[model samples]
Target: MGRGGVPRPTGRGVGVLAAGVLVVLVGWLLQAPALVFAGTTLVVLIVAVTISLLFRTADVRVTRRFTPDRGVAGWSAVETVAVLPRGGRTSGTVRVREQLPFGRLSDAEAAAVLLVPGRASSAVFRHHDLPRGRHRIGPLHVDLVESYGVARRRVVASGVAEFVVVPEVVEVGLGRESRALGDGSRRQREHSLAGGEDDPVTREYRRGDPMRRVHWKATARHGELMVRQEEQHGLPSARVVIAVAAEGWPDARPTLPPTSRVGVRAATAAIPLVSDAFEWAVSFAATVAVEVGHAGSATVLTTPGGTLVARHDPDSTTMFLDDLADLRLDDAPGAPAPAPSPREPVVAVVSGLGRPDLDLLVASRAPGSSAVAVVVTAALPLGAGLTSRPTRPADGRARADDRVLAPDEVAGALRDSGWRVVETDSSVDVGRLITTSGVLDD
Candidate 1:
């Protein structure tokens, strides 16, 4: 059990045995009366030794190797603990366990390792679940007994390392590697992104841009119709609000509509729903920064670096990603979703969009009237018969429906809600969708 307190070798048994043997031999040689007592004591000592040996737990040693570093929200960890048996009492089974804080990897169970007899014949328990901090692999404890129902013993060993998890990033999808960053603030970006505002010089005009602000002096020098091309704003970085589908998040309590009966809903409860490399979202965010230049919108990230408000710079992508790598996954109370403001659009990385809450969010961003663009990152997250616009409830009273909508159907629903939905084949292709899903005209 619990160490039974620390172990310190006791020499009492050995001393007693030695004394009994010595007394017996000396007394018998001297023909003394005490020889009888000595002989009896020797027998008792032998019995004691037999009893102790019978109960001693099989000699066991443990060696544990673990990945010292962890990503954000470290619910899954990799640790291999091997148990080796020493000479005496060869083999026995042991429990390989880790102390996990409550609420981490709720789905995981404790591992019971079976140890086989012989040297180096051990059991390795990989994929140990640990929290986001240092964990002590206390001394190895082994409880064994050779003679059944007779006696038992405990053996322990020490020397364990620590695993640290920083943060988990939820990368958003952005299209062009050039458009890695979404629109950022112009003024802030100029000062922060363009080498402290001294990097770019006024240059000539181009076809697509407004012309009245042309630089006549520069035109004289360059002998061309030059326009005042002030420093291009910093890279384009778009901040997004990410959420697991309301019903899909681990802690979600699905309040099924009374209208529809609750049945077994086939929900994919794994990361990277359609394809692997869910890291695609992160790649898109980086791309946006490259294409559009910063709009300087205040970023609100769900993951560590997921949110951003500053202007984009050469290092913006790196900074954003580094921050993203810092987030950890936890099912704390889901925070209230924020309303999209006028500054820029809001992109949401969600699991399922067929839910009613999703529609309201998109509807909030009035089509053709607001700058907000709602990008829903989900893989078949809706029920069937999804409606684009908020159709009047069948009863004529306003009520959201309980229906399943395909991803393409959701795209159309978004359009009906006054949003332009850019549907992608894979949620991983968030970049392509966001780049093309900008404000669409009627």
Candidate 2:
């Protein structure tokens, strides 16, 4: 039974009640006692059925739990719904429906399960092919139906859970180009400094020199004191700049306000092109961050809001992706404008770039620091699949005012401005795109 509501009669029950009245009228006209008695009995049966339906006790609750609440794209996750019925009264069937984040209710009959009254039951469903973002699941909908389907009580149990799907990471060797990024050389320096492999450098001994460090051969040859000196290792730090500024996008909605930070929510009806570009930027940023971390370099991330210092550890990487998952393009009218990026070697990820200042932002932050720019565009063929090396247009000229610029044009422009560049789209295999670009290597 449902609280604070009256039970309505089923269609069949209503028909039967009407037929009983008609039968009673016919009996009265014909002066027949048998028909009247039959009609009265039929009417009484209808009332009894209605009363049974109204009094039936059904206190059922449903809770949904998802296995591996967070996962990468393409992984399958299982959802288990536990049905608990109280009062030891189970005379009905429960049809369950879990809500999808996109405002669609899951299919009903497939999720339905019979209630065994006081005993609890569970049903399982699998979610697959989820995209990279934060998805909310749960708030199970249970429909209590009588054995004959004459009445139904709708129960909405509220317990919402969140599932975070992160970008997929594909393993690959960072080739010679990656070695040039200073990680390999840094390791060699570390080895030499530790004196585990390389011979210690010897020099004239000072008064404070340790006797163990004394070079007997040098001392005997020069007839003077000599001591071994350890070399210092200098590890190069890497900085990654990801351009998430909505205004920087060629197809960005001009009417939309500038966002104060990266995680600000966008409108539900954001333009499809803008949305696609945003996703590409985020995924590309995550992939690059991971690569830098794996390279044993200290990494810093610069986005539209500000800069975030990233690390190599699993927890740090997870948190970094979590921030990316929550990244959105908001309209901030009253917020202060974002500050210009400081000079640093940057792996700039943007939807588009044509401004000179934007070019300078991607150039070296200081001498000896290298920069790479990755342009994520939505103008590529949607279903043809991702391509890292986009071909130049026949004309080889790009309109500055176009809604989206060609990747080659962007690359050429950035190159002319003194930065290494790569072009890719959202659908491109992330691992291959960044690894083969030779950006991480520099």
Candidate 3:
């Protein structure tokens, strides 16, 4: 269990010992000196080998490195383990086994056998279909076997190491109007000419300021020269809200398509126990956030739990993906949703729309704000089995009878409240939907 090795006899060693005992017993009955000597020699050899192996230690250092450091879900990552012996003398044949999380990798890929290790031996393997989450890799188990395979010693070679698997971000295209909204030129001119006193896009006038550039309204209110700061209006601001509560998603367990690399075991660990609809929602939300960020917009990501990512910088985007990696249904069941930023574009990703969800979307529609709701129409594709009963709230707040609103009803309600709504199912490609649906257009 610790650094010290535990030596034990192999199956061949046990068989030899049993045979030696039987030979000795027969020799005693026959009163033969040569037979007794041979039996005694065999017994002595087995005992000596065991004792030698018990005293000998395989002093080696084992370290593991991951390619790209962080993996992406549904992708492949390479793991390389290097074993270096400390002393000049060669060690016995070594067998290295790395313990992976969730049994995602096969034994043959995770295990390696090396010949006598005089210098160093390294094993490199690729793990496919990486699950999203923080997973621990090691505390390597090393086995040292003698040349004859009579005795073996087992020891823990390395301590545990952890790596993160972030959610996948896909390319999403915005409509022409949506792209124009993100452009800084028109917004810069609007803010420069009509910015109020508290506007961040305007700043105190600097030396040699052009009179035409001065914001007279802000100047009059502040009793000082104020000029429009065109640089501050470079990037637009946007918000993305995703419904994470279990009650908002349907209750159905659908089998993954045959081509999916994620099996049941990996899925159970990587994804929350919620339905496929919820998983699709998370992926789509992540894709929207990244796409908005790429469009020169500072996007904030929020869940019912609260604000998960406040900024759309590279670091914040990474943090947002990390948060989505292990997002669970019961994480923030009854928590209040964060209010959307006023006058900013908002995108809400939801499934099995409920009363609370509708209220949140309706309230997010500010006078100048644009709100879009992407609703998953079906929990999963047709032919994928689904349960007839509704999903009860995991927090036990809602009864089974309080089923979610139908997708058409939810879309109609939002449209009445002056919001654009996009209806999709789990089977549709999120990127394609965003590109062709024209939901982001003005």
Candidate 4:
């Protein structure tokens, strides 16, 4: 655990000791003085080496650095480790091996050789396709070997460090209306051009108002001096709701892969055992939130439990991504649905919609607001044929025993309630849909 631990003999040292004992015994039995002298010399040498290494003090420090500081899932990251001598120089070659967390690095790749430790030695390696969530790395294991290679001492050079991998954000092309979707400048221009006397973007003229800034039509309508607001731009707001309840993703629930170290880390990090459909929903939601934030919209991200990211600013997108990396699923059913943001656009990414979920979507529709729902069809519950038997004849009528609605039925219900519903499976590319399907277009 510390630098002061005693040195132990290597296999070579053990062999030499055994040979020396055997030689001494043979010399005694045969009455040979030369053999006895050689055997004694070997024993003394082994003891001397062991004693030297046991008391030897070396000040070695280990430090690790990550290239970008922040790691993203599905991206490559470089880990650099440096071993520097503090005051004293190493007497012989030192074998340095980093104690990486369970799947961070292979045994061969985690080790490095410091030939002559009179100067600092460093090792740099790249890890590809970093998994999402948190990981622990390090506690450098330094093995000090003497010139004879008969004895070695192991010491802990560094403590463990934490590495966090945030969720990946895909760039989604919002098509021709991308600029108009969340751009404050475009919204301001359109509002100013089509606004009436009661336009919220205009105000009564104050003292020292420029004549060019005066709104003549508004002034005549109000019978008072009216002026256009200076640089007034209303940035659009959006709400992204992601369903996390286990009950919402019944059909798509899959057992975590037994051999996945990332899955284990995710569970230890408090991330839930999510279904494939839920993962797709989360990724889609994350991508949309980041893209919307890039477009200068204040986006709020919520789950069935509560709000995750309250406000999306320039830096909040990263915060939201990190939060998504640790997002967990709720076990209880009937968790309260997030309240609608009156007139703001709302996008709900969900799977297996029930009647309550459908009702919430319908109630979220306001006079001027747009509601969009991305339903993961792969996770939706099956019709009566799978879950229950129909009590009535096969006349395409509603069956009394039908408890869960099918994917198409859920989409139809939401569409009837004034929602723009997009039905997709987990394998579909959301970015492709945004570009070719015009899912975000007005």
Model 1 alpha-carbon drift over 4 Å, by segment: 1-68, 72-125, 128-177, 180-189, 192-237, 248-298, 302-343, 354-356, 363-409, 422-442
Would you list the rank order by lDDT, best first? 3, 4, 2, 1
What's each prediction's clash count?
A: 55, 4, 0, 0
Error of 3 at 270 (Å): 14
RMSD of 3: 8.5
Tell me the TM-score of each prediction against the true structure. Answer: 0.39, 0.63, 0.70, 0.64
Which structure is stronger by TM-score: 2 or 4? 4
lDDT string for model 2 (1-442, tens) is: 2342345556676787889999999999999999999999888877776666555555667666778767776677788888787667564566777666533544443477777877778878777765666877766666655556555545555567788877665565562236545453466457557753334466787643336446677677789976655421122445566565454453443222232123435543443223556656666666766666566443556553444423332225767777566655543223332233333346777655435335445443556557778877664454632223222334986444433234556677778877777767667777778766877666
Tens-place lDDT digits, model 3, residues 212-232: 456777788899988766643
- Runs in model 2 lying further than 4 Å from the true structure: 1-63, 90-92, 117-119, 175-177, 181-236, 247-274, 304-315, 331-345, 353-360, 379-410
What are the runs in model 3 whose C-alpha is more than 4 Å off?
1-53, 87-90, 104-107, 110-120, 173-177, 184-235, 250-276, 304-310, 314-316, 333-338, 377-418
Greater-lDDT candidate between 2 and 4: 4
Name the top lDDT candidate: 3
**Pairs of residues clashing in candidate 3:** none
User: Candidate 1 versus the native: TM-score?
Assistant: 0.39
Better candidate number, 3 or 4, judged by TM-score: 3
In order, the Cα lDDT scores of the candidates are 0.42, 0.59, 0.67, 0.65
Q: Pick by TM-score: which candidate is best?
A: 3
Give the better candidate number (2 or 3) by lDDT. 3
